[model samples]
Target: MPAEIALLFWPLVTIALYALSRVLYRHYPSAWTSPLLVTPLALIGLAIALHAGYRDYMRGSHWLLMMLGPATVAFALPIWDQRALIRRHWAALLIGVIAGSALAIASSWALASALHLDASLRASLVPRSVTTPFAVVVASDIGGVPELTAVFVMITGILGASLGSWLARLLPLRSSLARGALFGMGAHGAGVARAREVGEEEGSVAGLVMILAGVFNVLVAPLLAMWLR
Candidate 1:
């Protein structure tokens, strides 16, 4: 294939695999059966079998990454639609965002420090519960490895999805809105996705909380990093 045409090939292939993974997820219906887990594994295996370098694949795959900004911005529609609910729960939502963001950073930093992880790793882990784009920027600002930050974000998401449901139930809080807000503020995008499965009201609250959490992290991480230093 010509070089220009070849450039599009890998990206198309990745998209197809992702679509297939979504289908499988819908069919399987297991907590472990997430497209995020399956799609990357399938792509990595294919790349290895083809002897394709990760760098080369990334050159094409980055198109998908670029869309994250617009997708995030689009979430504003949901927020606008739910403005009434947001206004009603503004105080609780604000508290949840602050507490959740702080807990995420503090928990990761303390654990990593206790385990004697290097400074760079600790920095990367501290932003793990925020959205990936914000996390990457925060990690870079703190002199952490963006690649390591991405890995930590994925780990945080998986842990949240797996355990958040049980944890929410254990809490005395019976309001789905509050429960979903807690999960989204603590887990970011993955928790919001899980919240959608619970109910529409919960999902709307989750989306708003996730957005607030991202904003909180971006605004506060730099200050926290300075304090830690």
Candidate 2:
């Protein structure tokens, strides 16, 4: 393959696979069909078959990662639409964010400790519960590998989204705010998408909660790191 063609390959393949996965999900609607699950796996398989290096694959896909900033900002539209809901439930949202962030950090710490991971790996795992952008930053600030943190974030998201779905069904979460917070706090970006699937209000609340959690973690991260030290 020519240099230019090779550079474009993974990005093009990623976009096409994601689109196809979305179509499959809409038609079939199962965990197996999830674009979140399918697209990356397909890309990995393709890359392996073609003997593509990780650096080359990333060179093409970095642009897509940049889009996440705009996408995260776009979530503000939903949050703005539900300002009344937020105002009415400010106390609940505040409590939930605080508690959820604390628990997530604590659990990450415990998991890493149990595994006896080194400090760098332990730091990377600490911010796995938040969305990628936040996790990446937090990991860096705490002396972790940003790239490894991103992978952990994705894994955390898939698991959290799945767990949130199961809990939503099992628990009697009558309020949209409650349901939204459940996924948003647990899964971050993936949870927000899943919350959106559930309802507009749920999605909006989930977006708001996810944003809040991200911001909270970011602001507290420096202090948290110092305290841990």
Candidate achieving the largest TM-score: 1
Q: Tell me model 2's lDDT, rounded to 2 decimals.
A: 0.86
Q: Model 1, residue 188: displacement in angstroms?
A: 2.3
Q: CA lDDT, every prediction?
A: 0.82, 0.86
Compose the digit string of candidate 2's lDDT tens values, residues 102-122: 999898888889989988888
Error of 2 at 195 (Å): 3.2
TM-score of each: 0.91, 0.89
Candidate 1 worst ten-residue window by lDDT: 1-10
Cα lDDT for residue 24, model 1? Answer: 95
Model 1 Cα lDDT, one tens digit per residue, 24-93: 9999967577887888889889878877887778776788888878877786787798899889999998
User: What is candidate 2's CA lDDT for residue 44?
Assistant: 86
What's model 1's lDDT at 195? 88
